[model samples]
Target: MSEVLPQFRLLQPGTAEEAIAAKLASPSARVCAGGTDLMVAMRRGLVETDTLIDLAGIEEMTAIEVNADGLHIGAGVNLRRIAGSSLIAKDCPAVAQAALTVAGPTHREVATVGGNLCLDTRCLYYNQSDSWRKANDFCLKYRGDTCHVAPTGNRCRAAYSGDLAPALMVHRAEIEIAGPDGRRRVALQDFYREDGADHLALDPTEIVTGVHVPPSDIASAYAKLRIRSAIDFPLAGVAVACEITAASAHRFSIAVTGTNSRPVLFEAPDPLTGDDDPDVFFAGLNKLVQKSVSPQRTTTTAAHHRRLSVAALASRLARKLSAA
Candidate 1:
């Protein structure tokens, strides 16, 4: 007998209200914006949804608006637009920096912010096709009985590789979700549940509408470390946003991504204190980063390397932030 592909129902709505209704009516359905992450997951057979609700037609989901409150970027805006947006660069520089590191120009042009936030946590084992996974007895992230990367690990070992998330977290960004219950907003930090499969806390009946980034008066920057220059997920990434107080004082927020389950926020230290031979201060920062980056060897990179790189990347970001 010839094998048949799994059947699925499709719903494309022209407005946000229709999309919300369709989502609530079919709780098992999945949402797609740019389709970059979803398409890859479907090809790998990781997504079990039999129905897809495309949100691309929803007009409100693709418009960017700015106001006195802050900048509200539509969830469907592509990485290319986000990266090239002068407003985002001036107001949310960290986001622009992260967008620049997401992929090459092609991916940047098509991948949406919503897709990046909702990106499936990746694992070397889970990214393989079904046939390849079946041959290796599968892995915890997939249908396997064991975690190929960490045999003793009780949970899936996939890494949260999205570059945009940490930058948003550092900015205290909020995400708007539309559902049968209307709409609600939550801090982007709370959107993640710390589990690979259940990483997203979004309701099945909800569609991410947009992201609200609060205005910042100071300077910020983002740095990512990956095996390749472009189109590669980071082994480690850092976002630093700082504000200068009166009397030439400064306060900063440091966040890390691609090295843990979610963005790891660090307590900012005085970058000026270690001016003369900053080795002592760097040593302290390194120790703190080592404790902060709890990485698993789920992908090709080892846990040891990821942990060390966290400190290195943090140092680099600190220097950049200080200079800014």
Candidate 2:
């Protein structure tokens, strides 16, 4: 059965300040960037809102710029632009590659960076038709009391399946937020919490204005495991950023998504270089990633499969970057 959207007033804000004020003024208001994810959840009766604060018209949040500080990408910037941006690709290939993996090209055309960064967590038990959910007594992420994925746990087990957050986190990106008081910035990794029912660290009236990434000499790449080549969220994803370090030192970074409530970062192991045996190195890498990810039965795939795939992806990415 086709679901219907709740009645809501759309408030178009021309600036970040206006958007923050609009959200603060309406008690039942929710912010909308690209509306790619929010609208779908709203239609499914997962989100109840009377007003939507649209940030499409805000110029400051829709532009990309490069200065001495580094690359500044507005939150409203679409995934399509980010995927195809030469500057972004050259500066941080992981970000562009991650953006390209989001859904499909058409969805990317309209999906904004902010939307991806703040994507709602997903769980098979949580995402369902109203009738289907009612029959199951709903879920912990919504109206129900128990999380079907982890009934014994108090918090939700919905997975954060976004691909971009991990890639950005590897670059040490910072998030710019506009609120009722003023604008503030925080590290991108700090923007998310482990609780899936309430993932983003943003307040009700706060808006993610943009992201700032400093330039680095490291080379990086991104890859994800999905059921389909297009239009599907990742089952597990990996982003690897590595630099050519001194012969005695092995230094790099790895970030993962789709297996937990929030994107996770891991420090690369020392001595994980050409000197080590390929089989031995990969075995250690696999063990580390598998342990790092806590995959639940949140999707159709088995949790073990997702965990294995994450380890494989991490090993593959590290090998590719090291060779490059």
lDDT of each: 0.79, 0.89
Model 2 lDDT tens row, 1-324: 359887899999898999888987897798998898999999889888899998899999988999999899999999999999999999999999999999988889999999999999998887788889999999878888888888899999789999999999899999999999898999998998999999999998898999999878878899998999867999888998887776734566889998899999887666466677867876788789898889999999999999998898888888877666
For model 2, which pairs clash?
none
Worst 10 residues of 1 by lDDT: 269-278
TM, every model: 0.92, 0.97
Each prediction's RMSD over C-alphas, in Å, is: 2.5, 1.4
Best by TM-score: 2
The best candidate by lDDT is: 2
Candidate 1 lDDT over 49-75, as tens digits, reads 888888888788888789989999998
